[model samples]
Target chain A: MPRTVILGVIGSDAHVVGITILEQALEAAGFDVVNLGVQTSQPEFVAGAQDHGADAVLVSSLYGHAEQDTRGFHHRLTQAGLGDVTTYIGGNLAVGQDDFAETRETFREMGFDRVFDAETEPEEAIAALQQDLEIPLTETDAEEPARATL
Target chain B: MTRDKRLPESELQRIASDLRDDWPTAEAVEFTEAVEYHGTLPAEKRFAEVLETADRPLLQPRAGVPRLRDQIELLEGLRTEGGADLLPTTIDSYTRDNEYAKAQEGLEEARETGEDTLNGFPAVNHGVDGCRELIESVGAPVEVRHGTPDARLLAMITFAGGFQSFEGGPISYNIPYTKRRDLAQTIEQWQFVDRLAGLYTEFGVTINREPFGPLTGTLVPPCIAIAVMVVEGLLSATQGVKSLTLGYGQVGTLVQDVAALRALQSLGDEYLPDDVTVTTVFHEWMGGFPPDEARANGVIGLGGATAAIAKPDKVITKSPQEFRGVPTMEANAAGLRTTRQLIDMLLEQDVQIDGIDAEQEFIERSTRALLDTILERGEGDVARGTIRAFETGEFDVPFAPSESAAGQVLPARDDDGRVRILEFGDLALPDEIREIHRTKLDTRAETEGREPSFKMVADDVDAISEGRLIGRPDGSNPAPSGGDD
Candidate 1:
């Protein structure tokens, strides 16, 4: 069975464009995408992932409140019987001037398997997912290597 | 957490006084010019280029005709035979008698003439109506304000929070608050305003929809603030609101320069009503300058503190807890303490105002103090120190995360593929057109009050666009050139 990815905006933040773009990219990359539109909750994300038998749950937040907006999703996923699924988060996560390292750490502690900064390129995220899933990279993926390659 | 040692009382007092004095006068003068400049241009020209060049189709006509017809072979066969002449002589006579051509011509003429009407007015009206509809749909009240000073001040306050964001950007703070959760709270505050309006309407008060903000931040795009106001004036005629109060807070230094101020003043003379009173609120803390220089600029002194500067009647202060999305008990406590100190200073100034009392227990409870240690030290320190402070209970208030409160979470996937948010900045207009309108209106409004005829306003705006002005006088001279360009 093809691995499915559940993706969506998880709060009252209605920033739809970023999520829409990501969904398109993921689908083009051959991932069966379960896109929950804006204003989604943690439970909703978990439920969608479970229903779709998602291999991973990906989250995006542009509204700098991602820190407070998010919770222990890994634990929630485990409770929902999907602890094996990879969890990913990216965007302008915290509000104000905070260290990205500490922010990433905090999110990691709260159950995110991976955290990307606000400026993290989309290609880097895809690469990370491929690495974690042990999937072979495609030709289009080679065209834009990760930011670290540059 | 380290705190900066307090400056001497005398020095702080002097600085506070200076900031208070300088801030408002500068803001008032700058806003006055912004309103006046905006009013100088003919509304039609203000947005014509945008409409003509707009890539996205804002307007398109749809076809209404239907397809398909019933079979008329039997009737046609009868007509083709001997019955053909018996069908339509009476119908032809009736059709010939009708004067459809003349009526259609008259209607077309009216529409053509209406098409020449001011551009800014229609566009702004559309935008405002759209905004109002959005707000109302979400259960919020719409407040529309007219006149220069009021609009300018309002623009300043709305833009002040993001003053740093506008520098050198094509669009002034082009980013919409819809993306920022903290800024979104300010927008959401309109719901409270709507509730208030409803409460007042029950008392038979004619609740005027005063236009606040250039609120969406896009309220008036950068450089087109004046144009937005002019369009607003035209919109107000139908809206039935007479007076408008313009509020000015911390607008950027460059945008509010002398030239911009003059432009605002000219725009005001052309568009705003005579009775409209402009109020300027200069937050002393905005300008990072010595108190003495700031004082000369008419900044309202809220004691010696910047935060204490007088808040507007409808003040929207961000709760520290709300600022970063999570409630930081220490941050909230600090914010409240700062707010209280500022409020005390404002009360001492004896300024008359009514709204959220800074001293109220709820206000105090809701407000957090200035996390000076965190804010000054920067985000990394704040985030690190915040966690430490929360764990140790070193904060004045204990941390209690709201369980039921909806968290502002990010989506794992974005609809727009791009990680960043899209922004549409300021609207552009020909500089020559703006200048010409400014000169004509400024010359006229200084001498003539509200009595200037609409034709005169239009003529001045036209001449300004044309760069033709005769007898343009010295500074402070209110006379217009009598000669045609």
Candidate 2:
């Protein structure tokens, strides 16, 4: 069975296109994508992951409040029996844009398996997802290799 | 006479009562009395005075902290170092979202850390005296800037607390900052804010009301932004607001950005009420900035030059920390100093570009068509017309998340990096206007060797600071100054 991935723009943010593009790309790469659209809450994300049996929960936060919005998100997922799922986040993840290093570290310590920088190419995240999932490389995603793991 | 949207005397009294009851300290003073004390001040002290002067672009930096003393110090730092002609008190996100409790918490945290945990100052939670203290501490005209959709108490407190200027509008503020808000409701709420300004006007005080421009602050077509401004300006004027300042955000393409500012001021003078004071404000690049501080200064410098050439009444400065997070007071002043230097230097130079008239004319025609349709939709009642226009697809804003916005329009940049509508979507502009955008986009599509897609829009949105105006199909980017042709 194809690996299942759940994606959405987390928090009060409604920047939908970023997640929409990611959803389309994931589907084309043969991953089953359950897109929650924008303004998704932690409970909603957990529910989606549970309903879809998602192996990964990809969160896109462009408005810079994921720190507050996802403070205990990892713990909550663990509470809901999703602690083992791969977690990812990308896009203007902080309020202004300067604290990429700190933001990534904080999120990683918060239990995110991988944290994509705001400027990280969408494909880079995709390759990381494929590699982290230990999925065999499909011919379409073989041209570009994923960078070193975070 | 144009339909007066002013609240009746009884309703106005009731509104005031409820507002004051929310904050008893406000009830201790009179609104007119506050304006009387704050309004006579110079531009350095009274924001409306900034509009009264037209000799040079008044420079302002967005700086806010939770504590009154700290905020006062920050403003002083900006004034002493940045040489800011005007200063801002950007409200925290919690205050903006009407979460007063959260704002209070953030305030406590900020007080504890001596570092603001909140992104901005919480004027609402600080209440009347808090706002008054901040206003009194700063010699420069202090204004409130926030993305609040329902700013009822904020307006009452700030205006009564001695602020002579307020920013935001039903469409511009709501469509861009908020994800889910009813447009008609926000418009009506803003009418109250305007009516508050109107009341100040009745008392011989002129509070400068600026409609937030740069909806989405992305790749918005100038026509769409101008249409929203005209509608809001007309709506505010109908409520007896006499001092209105129009604003436009810089979009990186120098010619197009200058044309956007020029079109805004001209159309304001032409389309808005003759009785109102129509001035222009230029917002330095509201889009994404380079994380590199050096590159960001180049972006801010270009914005300053654009403002000087565009001849706006004032320019809002962006700091070097724009990309990372809330900037330090030092970064804010640094940006203002750089902007002042640029503006002063450009004032002596001609700074005029050839081939600008065509773009200016294009902006004018498009804005005219947008306003004409909106006015026709409401039979000349701007408030009613605005609601009707948004309900229909006639007044669409590109990439707006508001359920009230049609959000059908798609804008992209041409080979010359000027913003143009790739998909007009039911804009109701004349065929000729649509044809112009169609041709420009088609020409760009031919050069890019791909159909007009969202990829172009996404790339164009972040093209600035990457050293170019046009976001090419490929991920390859040029140096910061590579955009200079």
Which candidate leads the pack in DockQ? 2
lDDT of 2 by residue, A38-126 (tens): 77899999999999999999988887788888888888899999889999978777765376688779888988988887667666777
Q: Each candidate: how many clashes? A: 91, 6
Q: How well is candidate 2 docked (DockQ)?
A: 0.15
Assess each model's interface with DockQ, reporting 2 decimals per model.
Answer: 0.03, 0.15
Q: Which candidate has the highest lDDT of all?
A: 2
- Per-residue alpha-carbon lDDT of candidate 1 for residues A1-150, written as tens digits (9 for 90 to 100): 346888887786656545645664565455688877667788999889888888888898887878777866677888999999998998888876799899899888888889988556455777777878777765234442221221
* Superposed model 1: Cα runs more than 4 Å off: A1-40, A44-56, A60-69, A75-85, A90-106, A117-123, A133-150, B1-485
Candidate 1 global TM-score: 0.30
- Predicted candidate 2 versus true structure: per-residue lDDT over B1-485, tens digit per residue: 22327766677668778766654445555765676676555555767766567588889888777888988999989998889888899888887887777888899988888877888888877877788888888878888999889888888888878888899998888877766788777877787888889988888778889998877877778888888888889888977899888988888788998888888988998987788989888899888787688888889999988887887898999998887768998998999999999899898788789878888898998888888887787787777777787888888887666767766676789888888886666887889888887788778877987666555666776677575678887756666442211
How many angstroms is residue B123 displaced in model 2 relative to the true structure, after the best TM-score fit?
A: 2.0
Q: Please, what are the lDDT tens digits per residue for candidate 1 over residues B1-485?
A: 31111223354334334433422322222323333332432322222222223332111000000100101222122223311211100001111112223323333443465431111111111222222222223111122221111122222321211110000000111122122222122212222222222222333222333333232221111223333233223233222323332222222222222222233334434445564322211222121212122221222222113323333322212222332232233332333334444555553564433322321222112112223222233353332332233223221110011111111111110111101101111111224433433344444534543222222212221221122221122223332432321
Candidates in order, interface RMSD in Å: 23.5, 8.9
Worst 10 residues of 1 chain A by lDDT: A141-150
Which docking category, incorrect, acceptable, medium or high, applies to candidate 1?
incorrect
